[model samples]
Target: MPHTRRDHAVVLGASMAGLLAARVLSESFGRVTVVERDALPVDVLATGSRHRRGVPQSRHVHVLLARGASILEDLFPGFVAEAEVAGARTTDALGQVRLLLSGQRLLQTDIGLRSLLCGRPLLENLVRARVRALDGVRFLERHDIVGLTATPDGRRVTGVRIHADGGEQETALDADLVLDATGRASRAPVWLHDLGHGRPTVDTVQVGLAYATRTYRLPQGAMGKDQLILNNATPENQRAAVLAEQENGLARLTLAGMLGDRPPLDPKAFDAFAASLHFPDIFEAIRDAEPLDDPVGFQYPANVRHRYERMRSFPDGFLVLGDAVSAFNPVYGQGMTSAAMQAEAMRAVLADDRDARNGKPLTWRRYFQAIAKAVNPPWQISAGGDLAFPDVRGRRTPAVRMINAYLPKVHAAAAHDVDMSVAFIRVGSLMDRPESLLRPDIIFRVLRGPGRRHPRG
Candidate 1:
């Protein structure tokens, strides 16, 4: 084994990514500490708790991508099984989900990938419980991390400064490594600059998407079937409707639109907006479904990516992962998948018995290089879609335009053909890179598609 064994790893956030990272760290390090800003749930029930102030999008609908469910299952075995026992529906992706892609129904196939349907809070609660079971980790609740505590030479990050119950505390908790598993709103970049490290280059692609979602009580007979009715936005009509049944017998309907096309939060406008989409299954589903609460809205501006891998200087014993490194559009459903991959990447690096991974404090370059391998694929995966719309602005090169042209045809082919369908969904889910869809077989099929995909109303 390589010589570097961390005494502890300090994680900034305790949500999905935070808890997963803490679990991974516990395996490699003797002890792990997660500093979370919000108070964790006292009762382990998967009830729809009010949104935590730390996670602004908790109120929005969050479903695990197929790859994310697989990763979570491997990282914490029987987690999905437990969720299944608790009422999460584990249904085949292609067979169960009714997806209208670009305007057509994606062809059904036995993709072997299953998605776990549950709200964001319930998924977080299950993961938090799993992480807490590890003896090597401890969560310091209500301890908000303010800044990084670094040593002189600016070569290493030893700990973090927090605002805890102790009040304006400057106490230093020593660690062999400090992990920034903090989500999108992390202060890592600013803290890096404060420690004499140059600022990491950032890439932003704004989609300007917004959503208005409200929960409804599902009809009892409807509980067993994987209830996902998705209507995609056509170029002319820039709105989509997504309806899914959660584990708690609650159905969530999120009306999503881009540019200036936002669904109003008023209950009166909800049905009207839902009816305006390409398909109206979701609207029909919720028409008689019992409304649990008034509509809640979430506005996301862009996908932010920090090119830490290309940065010139980074301290040892310090690395940023998850949303602090990249945050994608929730509309694409990639955050948790990318975060799981990031944690798996970290674990693999820790498992490697070589200096190429992490040794005596990885240099800023070496550290981010490892992370870039994980982040770049998902970045391109998300950005490619956002840049598709003429209204969404970004650097659209010839290759991008070429991709835009090809993607529609590929997507069209996927609507009916089985192999192409599974391949496209695999790439879209971030289990594989976008290039994975470019196999010769898929390309030829997209160029000349087999007709007769399953028709959607």
Candidate 2:
């Protein structure tokens, strides 16, 4: 069936969610304007070396999980291949990465889980190039969204008022739809209140997560056996770290701390922090590596979710997705993947019903409902996992308690059993639902215990 085409659509922010949303919206709108407050990096296509100050976390490590990789490929054909050519490294998630969970190291094995490792700037550049080239998609850089223009009665959003960076003029760009992908600092709630609509309910989990990352040039073939190393903080130990292989023989080591604990910026202190991890592989490999940059730190105060699905009334022609909708604890590395999932949800909801394109109020509600469904699992994994840390304040339901209690068993079993490891990775990657961990077979294996014992230092 031929669907109706809209005149124009606007996406706020050019981050992952905004880029993905523009890609999806291009199919149904004649023109899609992406409004970004930060100036677009000039070398995004040529070098993939530039970063926008708006995205401070881009300085740290980021991974495209199995599902996000698949989605990006679907949205932009040859994405992985192009990324690889641009120096992004691909390795089987379970094969090349040393994973330690709950103090137990996963036995080295290939389980067919693939991950795309690269700096966030490089990945963003690739996606930005692809999206910029899409017909009818225009990048409106240096524009900040001030508020939405609405119908006289405030029943529908008509357009958005945007101010050019450092300019006195605020202009209105009319559109059939307005999507807020501006991330955690989204002003949609305030805009809604000013427009007389009730604000969406918000849920928050305080994590107080902090990270310090440094890039280094490894000695040739020094990171021989493994491409990545990860050690997660347990309830007993609130420190974590990951050393990820990046492009051009460069690697990034990100040390993480919780509840106000922070990795030091001094090189010696950072090395000591790495040495203090429960697992020493990261420190042993990077202690003598050539440093390319100083250790930089970023802080995440809490994980937030705007419960738009439960809103009694929302304006038509308005929608919010991506980190604007939910920002998870970065320790889980779920932000990019969650944004991709929300973009995918937008695509699904947009494609499934042609009638929904009529600019009706129900259409936005339906899309928010779908986004809520997509967010549930990752929310459960991140928010639920955060509860495991006693310092993190949250409501721990019976289900949360049960899952937390049983997860250590799963981690212990995964140290040696391939099936258990696979199950855990699958859930972590969002390829499978969290309930998959509760299946009888997995439960039986976890209770049966890890198959062997290995000495620890």
The candidate that wins on lDDT is: 2
Number of clashing residue pairs, candidate 1: 2
TM-score of each: 0.93, 0.95
Best by TM-score: 2
Please list the residue runs of candidate 1 whose C-alpha ends up more than 4 Å from where it truly belongs after superposition. 1-5, 46-50, 165-168, 219-226, 353-364, 452-457
> For model 2, how big is the CA root-mean-square deviation?
2.8
lDDT tens string, model 2, 255-369? 9999999999999999999999998788888977999999999999998999998888778888998999999988778888989998898888777765555555336678888
The Cα error of candidate 1 at residue 163, in Å, is 1.1
- RMSD (Cα, Å) for all candidates, in order, is 2.7, 2.8
Mark the regions of model 2 whose C-alpha exceeds 4 Å error after superposition. Answer: 1-5, 355-362, 452-457
State residue 11's C-alpha deviation in candidate 1, in Å: 0.7
